[model samples]
Target: MRSLAPQREETAMHDHRTLGRELDLFDTDPLIGSGLPYWLPDGATVRHTLEEYVRDVERRAGYHHVYSPVLGKRELYEISGHWTHYSDDMFPPMDVGSDQVVLRPSLCPHHALIFRARPRSHRDLPLRIAELGGMYRSELSGVLGGLTRVRSIHLNDAHVFCTPDQVADEATAALDLIRRAHTAMGITPVRHRLSLPAPGGKYVDDPDLWRRSTALLTEVLDRSGLPYETAEGEAAFYGPKIDVQIADRAGRQTTLSTVQVDLHQPQRFDLHHIGPDGARHRPVMIHRSIIGSVERAVAHLIEQHGGAFPAWLAPTQIAVLPVTPDQHDHARALVRRCADLGLRAHLSDARRGTLGARIRQARLVPYQAVLGAREVGDDHLALRLRDGRRLDPAPADQVLAHVKDLVGAHRTDLW
Candidate 1:
């Protein structure tokens, strides 16, 4: 049996409140109410960078981007069966005089509407549609955390509509895309959880479909030779799923992503395509999210790196410091050079304090500081690494090149 004592002890040691405040990432505003986050400028930068990364990956994986309204008609939820099954998680319906609408708690129903918009044929069988949608869920106040649990969430939702014959191939492709994304984000040793419904539980009423779907997912995992564990009673009401878990610094496991094999939604929505025999047939739906939620993933990255972000993800990758007021112009020039090279940089003038004090301040903020000075009767600068090592700066072009290379390499250790 798993002990809850260790979980309580671990929670005490890693206080998210202190980390969130110290890092200036996110904060709860009383005026905004609980479960809502007001991301500071630094936190916003990290969030946007992560979104861009995911968008690029989705585009390369052949997903067509789409946008849906945050509020949907009450009838849509009824058709999707969310009104009956997951209604507790949704916001109360608002009566718009003639019609009732509720804040969206998930993107699946909206994506289904997109599929119903047109008459799809077998040629468009494997239709991949993705959306970075803002969804709302009314959480109990006690469950709210910085970014881990929230009232509003941005999800990287992708739905693959494939014919029954192509379902396995599409599932494999989705898994490949997720693997590539984990690699890009430096999430190592990815673990999978084959989640199924508990026996005689709130699963879809078809026992045969559940058995076949679970077996298919198991075969995929086995063929890939990836280590996984069976998780009973963790599946969605619609179907079984594969949960991707990652460990943090404290060794606490969290679900970072998921790929669910949904066999009910497509049929409920009557999604169909023309088959080779010219007969109408139901298509399979595969729901994949490489990063579970934008806000939650950012929180995980924060704790994983302890707020010292990698070069590519850092808000300020480099800080320029002038040795004296006389070198202020040189420092500003370096900042511009870095900016031109697509690196986030800041200039620290020496008038505020002594050179050593300014360097210490830069270090406190955890940025790579460059100290500009006069050396050997020539204008020169010293590159101060995050580890306190100082190196003679080369030409401006050479410095920019090196910084670009470092960022490209995603070097977390070098500074």
Candidate 2:
């Protein structure tokens, strides 16, 4: 079994809470709520960057993106089994006249209703619906800390509906997507678990459905040549799932991505599709979350790289510093040019601090472009990286091109 405790390390200097406060990434207001956090401009930029990347990846994987409300009618969760199974974790409902509605804790039930909106045919066997929607949960105040454990969550959630014959292929594709995303984010999976039902009645009461789903998931993982452990009683109430636990730089394992094969929700919601034989048949639902929660991913990444983000995802990619007030115009012009090239750049003028102090401040950014009298007169730039490596005078075009290349290629370093 994997332990939930974080490994002891001398990480106080690089703690996410400290970096978040110092860099002005996010803040929590007690008047607002204990577990709720407000993202500052810098933090929002990082989250928006991640959201765009995930959306593009999902689009390429043939997913149809959709948006749903954060509040749902009480009946919705009742039918989906959340009212009975997850009542303790959900927020209290508000009485809306004769009806009651509550903030949604998950997006799967809402997506299920969308699938039931219209009739589908075998041609639309694998209908993949995706969303980056916010969810609310009533977390205990004592356990709330930073972005990792919050009451509000924004998830990259998707649900796939397919025929029984298409289950294996869809499962394989979902796992592949998870692997690709984690690899790109520089995360390593330390363990995999094939979660199954146990003797407790916490799961949906269907022995045959449980056996079939477990067998199918096992077969899919075995055929894909992926090694995993069988974890009994760890499955969701409606399905068996495949979970990949990723280890951070501090050797802490957190399960952020999952692929579940659900055999209960479709039947509860009466979701169906017409087969080639022109008869009504129930569809199987596959719930997959590649990056899981945006807040959690950002928290993990902050600790992973110690707040020095990758070039492509950094809020401020470059900081331009002029040696003195005389060269302020040149610094501004370079900043504009960097912006034109689709880079996030800022000018560190003398008003903020001295050139030396500004250079030290630029450590929060990825690259620093130093402009002096000699370079300005020569129409060149003196580059100093965050790592304190100084580059000789280089032509304007050459430097800009290199910066653009690094950003485009998602390089972690300026070199």
Which segments of model 1 are wrong by more than 4 Å?
1-15, 364-367, 375-382, 387-392, 409-415
Candidate 1, 37-90: lDDT as tens digits? 888888888888778878888898889999999999999888887887788888
RMSD of 1: 3.4
By summed lDDT, the worst window of 10 consecutive residues in model 1 runs over 372-381
Root-mean-square deviation (CA) per prediction: 3.4, 3.1
Model 2 stretches astray by more than 4 angstroms: 1-9, 248-250
lDDT of 1 at 318: 84
Q: 150 in model 2: Cα distance from truth in Å?
A: 1.1
For residues 183-217, write the lDDT of model 2, one tens digit per residue: 66766778889988789657788999998888888
Compute each candidate's TM-score over C-alphas. 0.90, 0.93
lDDT values of the candidates?
0.78, 0.87
